[model samples]
Target: MVKEVQKRKINKEEEIHISSSDSSSGDEKELMLKNPLKWWSLQGKRNPTETKRITLPSTIKLIYVTLAFVPRLALYGLVFALGQCCRAVAKLFCSSVGAPHLANKRILYISDYMPPQVHGIALRVSQYTKYLRSNGHEVHVYTCCVESRARTSFDHPTLPFVANPFNSGNQISYTAGIKLAWALGAESWDIVHVFYPNALGLFVLPACRWRGIASYCSHHVAMDDYANRYLQIPGSPLLQRIMFLLYNFLYDACYRWPASYWGDVNASMTQTFVKRHLPLAAKYSHVATIGSGVDTQRFQRRIPTNPDLLWLWCDSQCASEREALCKRIGAPTNAIIWLMVQRLAPEKDIHIALDALASLAQQRKKMNKELDVWLVIAGDGPAREGLEKRAEQLFTNDKNAPGRVTFLGAVPNARLPSLYRAANVFLTCSRSETFGLTVTEALACGACVALPRCPVFDELYGHVLPESWRYDADDKCGGHLALIDAAQAAASIEASAWLEANPIDASWSAAAQDLDRQYDQAVKRGKTKYTSLRSYVQKRLIHLGRASLLLVAFYFVLSYYWRNIYCAAQCRIFLPSLPKPVRALCILTFIIALEWCHC
Candidate 1:
């Protein structure tokens, strides 16, 4: 649902050139135009090759561009205008058209937080519910709420937000499921969609299935990939096998439906998690690729030029990578500014970034007799103060370092786009990732991303990094070394040995470029395919809604006529308990219900 909105909002104004144009900038463009020698690029150039190749769909493509692209864009504009006519009118139609399937289908969205949580999954959940409600569907989101914080801009007060377990991470929402399911039992629901297959989904999967309800599990992250480095050690193959078996048992025993795992790229650990235990892929044939939701409304490709801003890296993964980059550039400590937007947990390995920065500061003082750098840390977690003290201790030897490093805890979701825009470059150094949503947002915002070439990272960028910069951890440059240490303690050292035994094709830079080009091609192809399907879907939904209205009206009228007959037999115009005016209102309602049936 989130991805649909994103694809729909791509206006004609955003020129998507198949061939590399001279003026495009940033990583996204760089990836798209990586292969200048490709057929797409060659066709645009003045090359003399006249050899026959696949001909162009010039007439058909033009017709499609004119009929589908142009009209839909114009229609979209009209819809926007209609919305402005009145708040309710706009909300009703946009939401309705956006999610017509919701009218007949009761959707239960089990998530961690509705909104005000900056993570990708949370924002998408909020959007899905809003659109679903707009379509007149009985949409309900069940999650725990923080009492101190108010609802977010996207959150509607009337929307139900059931409170439960409170954890900084969105994955831990087990406490709310029992109550949520109990509340939902009263409603006639067609399907239950569970998010983050690891935690909340695990809890909700079985109960929904037992009732013969259509169930879906959106595997946002594979559990094996997410476990702390300690759990991945090779010596613990027995434990690893045990964990994998347990996970497989829970998923297999519970779900008869095809379980879906959607992620940016298939990480080694995630794939291994499946192959080691769930050997047969045929069991979960419903596995399809559903990319993470992109908020087209919030993030656009507008490169902000703030002269005062030296760097703007989100605190998630790039901290350590940025430190290495700073060292390679030999940047002056003060001239270099770094931002770390991450949970201040010990496992995040933020201290490595900090330690590297501090080393740079000392080197600058010894060589140039002066060094200055500002480290801005965002996000609050259990290790916040501990990280702060460590930061202070590391920089104690410096003269201007007191005010240089600042930790502005927990910036809100609304401010992130601007933060990405303000910064010159973005960095993320996490050893593992399930397609970092922030990384995509940062790239879209036009910052050069400095990221490790992990499976998820490679998948996210479509393998579009410069060859010199790409690191798959298996490369001679110790790219895969970090992962080695992470998997050292696995139940059997064989898992780690197996990982080391087979090296990945570490051609991420070219891969990223190819991925982006393919994505553009996909978007172009998908638009046409999507348009046809969308129209069909819309028709089906509208028909379903009309049919439902008819059934509801028929029920109301039949009940009314029966009541009138009963009243007449009693020798009374209406029931004695009901007032005359109330009886008349009931009659009026019956008439309206009849009208609804006809409409």
Candidate 2:
């Protein structure tokens, strides 16, 4: 009974997660990769990579789209200036600081999200921590209490768009500031690495400054897009206009609130970001390792499965176990398993896959083709219930869907290999992935993939996956069918050749190595203040500006809510018996109280 309880407790904690390097690090290769514009040459194309734009409400589109980037630009300026000054100071002060001690360093990770939260940040931290520990690093994870998935409900309707006022998306641990402040002060750590920057991760920046520790702020997600993505009201053209108006307020609240964006070294998940906009991110931006190192090793590792086929699972035995896996997941034994492993979030664009699958079924019927394809979703999120309903609606309404939906809710990390091995083709309708760990895992299992026509995917897989493998995300009507067809084509190609063409090298140890280099640099530099008064003055101004920005953001949220509440409620509080100013003040106070209560 105790063992079973412990097993359940363990199951409650584990969750799915997060990146990729641009290219090889050979001196010439590094130079070529550093200029992401030339990345097209690598993918057997001459065209440069381009960033996709997320359309926002026109009210603040000018500010959010045009002016919102100004802050990030200013941040980049600060980092570059600080980096140059810091480098010179380190050279002068610690010229004899000697080689960095890559091993046995004390590390502290501050994040609101941690394993077993089933988030990419949690898994990224877990995997990297394991690598660090194995290499003799003493690491401590400081995070808020991880809530159980069962305790949370993911059954909310998505069409009308229920979301946070700030639009950070769901499943965030908000109460951690006091706990993290205490933990940072208690530990005499060498390095503090932050996984999620929107919350407690931001607290580490100042704490590390005071403690004189090296700090790293990882930019895992492009979060500004979340408001527009999740809070989308697609019912009517008028509803979409209202959605646009609603998101403008949400963006105002979220923009300057994130302290992680101001860190000296921002680690990006992909090198494309570094290449295109922030060149300095290269030093901190590193790729997390894929499962095990070798493709064979990944398949060989499993949990509570058939022991005889454990080692050589990816070989011939993978096919034999496919039938059993289908049975386990309630999928048709003869069905072509199309697996999508990700948190079912609005940003994931899962409905696109469903829609595409529905179209594929219809097209196949029209052509009299036989394809029994089942989309096996292997993760859960706040959007899961809505997604399930959407799938159901698609199946019922379309009727020609090739196969039914099989939701294997949050499959344990260990069993992912089996699922991947069983899957005939991997499908991702999400265009928002930085570099999906699932994509790499699927390829390792020798499965074909259908990728969206997003810049990140194009750069990462453009060279490897065939031209037909790409599908238009913006062109949603026939795009999904094209993606499905591509996946089918991929399955027909030589597996060995396919794996070779893929740029699938993400060593967790290599990520650790990058961290070690940063650690050594920070240790050697110590906590020296910027020597130049001019730079110091610039810093103070920027610091004050950031504070002002925060206050302005708070004001914006308050003012927007105040106006909305007053208008929406249709308050007629102008008392003729009372003084005009007094009545105005009373109404203002009431609005403030209402907004606070809502918050």
Candidate 3:
């Protein structure tokens, strides 16, 4: 009887234990279903015996799948719908306006400078005007009167006007405003395109608006950057802020406002420039990137079998003839020539190239390798004298010998093709370049190019050129090392093969077609709806608000720091002899003078 009772108790206890275990297992299964991510993460830690296939409920599984894809599906759907809507609107607008009819335009190109300026903007204007005329468009240019010697055959029909006495540069001519306005009033123009928003553009844009003519402006240089570089202002926070305010005010008044108020489009040479420098213009006008193109057919490789024969060809007076000038200069046939074709300006960073070359020469000597390397600089500017002196100091040595570096001065455009072809490697170390025309020309001529790692260079060649061709110019040692590597690569058999494969399309015809499309778009947008008076009023208010804010900030800074500044100015090292009272009076007087000037 006792044994029977013990057996019954054990069986009951076992049943109870089993029930509790089953309940715990059910709870764990529910938890796993609720948090599959956690469950999966912890799955690897579980023993093989403990592992089991998890059978989730159909409702839960469906919910999980839906959650995973619903947001992505909705986002994709929205994008597709927006794209379709935009396409439909554009198609409808084009059809209604008969855009195809306005294919060939009567263009009036208002430029600050033209050919013979020997500047990038001038070259771009000349090329664009020439190509536009070739494409069956009647194009006329209005520019300031230049010297008879500075004029080109292409300048025919280009109306030149007298400039103001106070003009800052050869390009800027204040008096051209009146002539431009008169010309616009008399003529019928389909489109008025301003190359640079200088004094000329300010007048031309307003005249185009008054005459109800479509207009556009091309952003060539970043004025703020130029000011910062050239002004030699101390890089203090207060000074930088003040400089920024001044630059912004000038840019808005002279360029942005005029372009936005009167012009239908604002074009930039590169997409990078359009994004970085023309944000305000972009907001109000149809911003387009119509990059300057290269003459690819003319700039092809011509490796001559005989150097002397090429030299003879170079000496001939045939302007149309192509010949390798590098061969004529007695550069070694086996030497790797690194060529630079750029203005010798401070901003161009020509000194960096020289430094790299010096370093390369030293490295070659140390390695006991044949120092068959040469650097050919092919342009001139204000920095030429300094650069030449520096080059002479660095390169002209008894052991290494001279002629390692050569200055070709400013080579003509007609001869540039041959110059580019003669060099094994073309290099540019410019700190800032909107669109590197020389770099593109070099690449088109089948020369391997080595560029400093800048935004412009990256945009131009990061995808197309090999990684070995680019170097961080910001690093001194790295830049020198990169130049050495590039020279070695250029000398190798693989360089020619690489150049043949990676041909960039940089033809003027392609650029003209792009511009044509932009012109049509600009015209379409201009005709659709004129800006309302309310919009103009809003813009004026915004401009006023910005000015007021800047003024207030300036006042606050002056008021807060005037004492410190005054004390600093009156320090023993600077103005020790002056009395404190007199110094205080002087500071007060200066402040008053500033206020008077402001008024």
Instruction: Report the lDDT tens digits of candidate 2 across residue range 1-599.
Output: 11010011113212210002334335434434465333322221111011112223223333543453445434534553454455444434434322354457877766555555566666676667667777887777655433355122211111111112222233443323333444555435676776643444333465466445666666566654555554444337687677667655543333222332434445555666434333434443332312223233454323325676653324456656797877765556777777899976667778777776777787778988744777788886556656666676666444455236767677887777777778778888877676677887777666778788877787677876677666777764546667766767655646436654553565566766676777666555544432355446645755675677679888998788667645544544455566655666677778778868999
Per-residue lDDT, model 1, residue 439, is 61
Query: Relative to the true structure, how large is the alpha-carbon lDDT of every model?
Result: 0.45, 0.56, 0.63
lDDT preference between candidates 2 and 3, better one: 3
lDDT agreement of model 2 with the native: 0.56
Best by TM-score: 3
**Candidate 3 residue lDDT tens string, 216-302:** 788777666555554333336676567558657866876777876676787777777777776666677777777678865576554
Ten residues in sequence with the least summed lDDT for candidate 3: 1-10
Please give the TM-score that candidate 3 achieves against the real structure: 0.63
lDDT of 1 at 389: 63
* Candidate 1: Cα lDDT at 352: 54
- Model 1: lowest-lDDT 10 consecutive positions: 1-10
Winner of 1 and 2 under TM-score: 2
